[model samples]
Target chain A: MMTVIYIVYSAVCFAVAAALLVVALHRACKARIAARSERLLAQRYVRMITALLISDEGAPMSRFAFCGRRGAKSVLARALASVSRSTCGDGCGVVRRIMAANGVEGWLLGRARRSRGYGRARYLSMLASLPVSVSTANFVGRYAGSRNRHIRFWAMMVRVVADPAAALYVLSTYPHRFTAYETAAITAVLRRGLLPLACYPLLTSPSHNLKALGLNIVRMFGMADAERFLMDIISDDADRDDVREAIFAVAAMHLPVTRGEIVARVRGMSLSERRSLCRRLACEGYSASVIMRLAANRDRHYMETLVASYKRSLVCCG
Target chain B: MRQVLIVGDSGVPRDMVAAAAECAGCAVVCVDDMAQAAADCKRGRFDRVVVIGSAPFFDGRMSVGQLRPCGLQRPELYVIGWHQSEHTVLGLLEFGVNQYIAFPVNLRRLCRKIGAPIFRGI
Candidate 1:
């Protein structure tokens, strides 16, 4: 009985080892095949892009025969998107023409519709990179309120690109508060001339996040015209974050903020807020006297120490 | 042909910039590391050093004083930034960068800046 049990145990162990080996081999083979295909795809992309770059405007569209290959649309889309992103002016027009000719938009829309989860989001992101078309916008709008936050974000992005004129409206109504990453992404899209010709709408929006974004835009573009609006936010907006953003924008743009306004704002702010404001103003090259003037009697000693320390740090860094 | 050195991490933008430069009749060399790029500039006579991407600049790695230590031959420095702010532009100018090119990169303008004729065609 003992001999029989030992034999069975050995047999079981052998079978398990054999299965493990088979799985390992299968994975290895699969990885090798995938790598080979990726290499081939990369080579094709290089060839296609090189040809497109060197080809003349009058070059026959038929010469890009690879566009018609099965399973090449996604690869082609990626390559074209890369080209389009790295270029502006006439180069953008050239890429758009190629995408249109190959029915890339329709193909992408179909894939987006059929996909779910991350796959759907991926397609929407790709679509966002392309020029906004009425059809693409209409399709993407359906997913704007998707249950998945990821999908909803990408859908909102597409909407922003499709009609930048309504960017403030779309952003203001965003169901969730904008994360930093989302805000940056949206700001990048807006920079692409998708809309919001003026940031006045953003400043006027009820959403604090949108208002902050508007302040950021003003600072970024050096929009002198928005100074009045920024001052309004500074004086009236109760949201600390929005107020901080407005203050930073004002400091960055070197807008005139009266000493009385500074003293009043500083009086209401906590010690940390005062410190941050002082640092920002200092960094923006505000005169020592001007920054000192911001300190209320209660915070004079603290403000003096802060200014001295900041100056020392600057010297050390330099 | 003009020799151009592109300093940036490997990305679509850097690759496209290299391709555009090559198309415009320049021999392009791309280096991912700022140190390696500085070394290459010392080793080769690059007509222009196009620094693509903002990481090196914003991360406080590449600076005007740092570039001097590399002994570069005073090649025109161009920084291609994605959505650069006024502060960033001023900083780049202070760092002795010849120009600040914003994204999406205008390939034609880039070609012109490098003193190369714009390559016509798609």
Candidate 2:
């Protein structure tokens, strides 16, 4: 019994020591790899940045060549990203030209095709940051309908880059409404001076969510003509939710629309939407006639929102 | 050496951040979820906490909310992701997150933020 116990203890000690040795070896290897990459990164990064600024495509590619094709691609990827963030206007155009000159577009397309789901998503994101090209845009569009949310999200960004109007259309009709990321991405794209006037027609879209998105786009872009679009949509029998969104947008923007036009549309809207509109109108300091009319409707929740807004306005005005 | 607590699933970005942290002469402890990160914050002393967002966090399905109560003593919170919105960025800032970095990971900015002087030129 004593001999058996001694043998078991020795085996356990050996096993633990082996595991520790493996861990130490693995960490050392990782450390070495990191040190090597950091050294390579330090040597190559500044040269690439300088070459990109000059728009001399050959210089960046040649500088990257010192790192070999694979290493060069990694370095260029970082440089491309840095340039994308730090510069804009024709400078961005220069960076894109340099990227194209480096064969990044083709390499990205190949990466997109050959990589698995996550790899493909990463490449799609990289492609989105580049200037839109026919092949990259086409490749991204094919994945816009992908069931994987990551692929769809990145594809939408690429779509927004390649064609904002078409992307807006896709968002309007997409079965799934915009996720927060999608909303932010679309907002960012539209804020990049993409015209909102073109998306006004979508206010009449059959999807209520799409209409809301249209209203948001209009609001974010501050298309003043959109007031006419909003009034027209509400004047017709439109989704109460969408009308609420427009009113919210209007109030958020502090844009003035005819209060009478809004009051006229309220009879057809839901109590909740009417309440929201009342709150907005009150907050925007619209005429008392409209506020009193909605306040008189007497749904308790609706009344509370309006009354709260009215009271807050009084506090401000008083 | 600076000690960083990285909160996120195991992935390329996480690994990159960890490697970067190490290269900066900092020690890294990685936890796969917020709960683990919270627990580590109680038990560990860290100089920075980097909440690396994966596709899920960027999708708005997940968040690293309110880091102040996590027992971290003066650790700056940095978020790294791809394509986070201004609203999200502002929200993170408001919630006491120190920085939100939208990727392809900016090594110079990242190294600088972590006090990693190894990048040299930046």
Candidate 3:
């Protein structure tokens, strides 16, 4: 019985060691295979995609064959997607041709419909990098409220880029408030002043965040074109948050387009309202005298800290 | 051939780095283990150094402090990863990195950023 017990213990030990060895060997093999595939992908598909992007060449037979292969197709898809955003002129034409040749565009659209979670996110990200179309934009717009934050953000990005006014409309009307990161991503696209004229209606949105977003975008794009609507929004007894956003817009406008109207309104404002405007002006680096005078009127202690904050901002920003 | 040093331990796929560098007409020298990257720095200079993976940017092992002691100089440094906050990207700037290409490196942006002049069909 003692011999039998010893034998059993030895067998258990041997099995455990052998299992560990097999796992280690399997991992090593996988790593080696991955490395080899990467080398092949880099040498074969990456350069071809790059060449197609840089030149006006049509999709070659090589790309068509690569799409049929297992490892090569994924490599081709990812590499093509990577360059899609920057492509323009003939660059876009060539990439589209390559995708057509490989049937990648159809595969992407098909996979986009079937996927969920990361798979869907990846497909959407790839789709965003492609040139815009009504169908693709609508497909992305469908996920604007995806339970997955990543999917939602990327979808919002696609929609916002495709049509800012509509996206912002949906964003404002929806109960969801985009996280700061999502807001920044959407804003970056609109920051360049490409907003459609339809943004005017959103300024009156019942949603505070949406109204604030519209005010900020109008301010950022210098849509002095919206000065009339802005004047109305500023004068209206709008949400305090919306009013604060208007104060920021007034500050951003600087010289007299709407500055006179803003100054006239400021004289009738409350202390808290004055404080909010002064804080925004300070942050936006409006002329120091304006903020300093307001700070002094608020309180001596507030003035001292406000002055210090301005000094720090100047030192850091400069 | 133009050479670049890529330091990371978090298993960022090797193909991504190689494709980016090669597309820009450079070759990549990947150092999988951060300690080994520090050791390798002593051997020679690289045209560019890319740091990726893990948190706090390059972590303590692959920080500039370790690389500088080994006499590496003037190689353009880049930090690439998924950044949770702008503060972390700003913190890396304090370390003298040349650029921070966040994760899902925009290939065209990366090419333009590195001054490759390959896109624009130019």
Give the candidate number with the greatest TM-score.
1
Tens-digit per-residue lDDT, A1-318, candidate 1: 999999999999999999999999999999998767655664456445644654447554543455666567777777666655445554445555666778877888899899999999888887777775766887788998799887899888778766767766777788787776777666666665555546897898778778777877887788888988888887888887787778778888886655455457766888778777877777776767777776556666776676787787666655
Docking class of 3: incorrect
- Winning model by DockQ: 1
For chain B alone, what TM-score does every candidate structure achieve against the true structure? 0.81, 0.78, 0.75
lDDT of 3 by residue, B1-122 (tens): 65677776523234455556666767678777657766777687666667775363443434666565434345666677655344456768787666776554455555545444222211
Q: Predictions ranked by DockQ, top down?
A: 1, 3, 2
Candidate 2 segments whose C-alpha is farther than 4 A from its true place: A1-4, A7-11, A14-18, A21-51, A54-87, A116-119, A149-183, A193-214, A221-225, A256-318, B1-122
lDDT of each: 0.72, 0.63, 0.62
Candidate that would win on lDDT = 1
Candidate 2 scores a chain A TM-score of: 0.62
As for candidate 1, its clashing pairs are none
DockQ of each: 0.40, 0.04, 0.08
